[model samples]
Target: MTAEKEPHLSVARTATSPSAVQVVDLFCGVGGLTRGLEDSGINVVAGLDSDADCEYAYSVNNDARFVHANLLETSSDEIESMWSAGAVRVLVGCAPCQPYSKYSRGTSKEDPSAPVLRFAKYVDDLRPAVVSMENVPAVSRHPAFNGFLETLASAGYHISWETLPASGFGVPQTRKRLVLMASRLAPIALPASNVAKAKTVRQAIGRLVPISAGEANKVDPTHRASALSAVNLERIRNSRPGGTWRDWPDDLRAACHKGESGATFPAVYGRMEWDVPAPTVTTQFFGYGNGRFGHPVQDRAISLREGALLQTFPQDYKFEKAETLRSFALVGRHIGNAVPVALAKQIGNAINSHLEKYI
Candidate 1:
């Protein structure tokens, strides 16, 4: 999957030039949202993230400055330093969602600090002209999340929010995320679903240059899966596409599969269907036993490039240099956690419509 080069624009003296507005990405893991916004003519000036892995990808890929600091600890004065005078500011945040995700249901809410609450504090302090947040749909229902929205409302922002399916916006994955946009200028809405027919797994990765287990593609090395342990290989071979451990032979079942509690969660240790969009790609997509992460047609797990493509990233999106396998993991996590690029582009287009009215 080759990346189509971005169109270069020459300097021009105009009121509506790309440089007129500056976007600050918060919790900007690998700059997925920033890339989409930049593609839509937004000037992405700075990206803030605590993860060291984000530095190279955000800086090199987006050509934006990367600030390595905890978002919860950063002060408004610190944020202001990243902006130029007289530039329209846009605040984009996708706070860490693990605490509020369905995966964390067993965790207690009384846990000392919450990152989402801290993120709202930054919004209150900065009060940028535009604010956009994306997270799991469950976050919208959380009391902490509701309070964040109220804070924005009290600050005079007209807000609109919804839980959107990524497939609706042309991502070839069945991922649903919550998106919010607020502005003092006027009301804002998310972009309407563009893909009636969801993109299938085959459409997304079937044409990729094939590679054997543990072998990277010759043209694009990133499109490669990790080597599987002998036990894991046998486990995957026993799993059927769209089927789970229940479909496995009794002799091959894991010890957990023999228990009653494990019987209830059947989506794990499964393969994806070639005709349908993939199940949500997670950070552990390179592991066959992680969720329904096995490739639809291939015998191994989906490769790094396949995971990015499923997340709506262009084929040639740069990952960290080879020495940093950990950076690759971080990049994969950020990509998996991102609001699909296709969806972000639609959100950008919606904001553009509002901008047109003001301009």
Candidate 2:
């Protein structure tokens, strides 16, 4: 089915009921999380992020005020003011998870800047009616992560958390993320996976307005890729669906592939499969050497548009203007990292059902 026909898909913000609960999105890179929340009838009053590139897209797409401030630096008073202005204060945070990701396997925690732990401080201070956090699955096992849950418990929240597979909720990718929900109203469970069969790359991107190398889609310009060099062009052509660099001829393989470290990173320099859900779309999705980012049938790495679409972004979602490459990257990264709209909506639906008693 075309993305347009997908019932769960929504992009641009719509007018919500005045009774709609207001949300404050923390670390709201480009508002992907807010978009999902807004679609579920939440009014996103504001979005906060450190990256300036996120400002335009977050503001324009979701029509929420964008605050370019580091979560660590922003004072509790500032957060409280923002929350008080909203109808029903919902604090959502997606702290940086790279330091705790399984991908950073050999890295030591002794590294000076560990920001994930700081999220607990924000939770302690704001004390919103509800708190939701999403992050890499590996983080759930961390001591700091456990401590954060403890902090929430101390604040009188009945919490529910689980590691969820994105594909289980109809996302066209195989990614696992930890989702946590805390509330005083009662114990809140996240939505169950809605998908019975996994969606594939073909199902996600096959019908989008197509564009050539270095060309932008006229209808929605952000759906384009930077042009490929001659060598890279040939490399992508030889890469088969779901196949890695091992399929390449000796002459075509990068020198790194012949080395020991390279052998361990087989998923890099790979192509996506048409029949299976894509590998987790990451910030570097526009780069062919990053994960299985290449199109299964097309001879180009997935475009920014395809990446966003695979993440269930609405076709009409406004990214940064055409000239802002950095903004596009920020928007793409946020969309890639976002909880799938379908998944978020399911969570909202679950919350709605749970709230029926009070309503």
lDDT string, candidate 1, 263-288, tens digits:
88788778899899998877777777
- Best candidate per lDDT, number? 1
RMSD of 2: 5.9
Best by TM-score: 1
Clashing residue pairs, candidate 2?
none
Q: Any runs in candidate 2 off by more than 4 Å, and if so which? A: 1-20, 84-86, 103-114, 323-332
Which window of ten consecutive residues has the lowest lDDT sum in model 1?
Answer: 4-13
TM-scores, all models, native as reference: 0.89, 0.87
lDDT for 348 in candidate 1 is 75
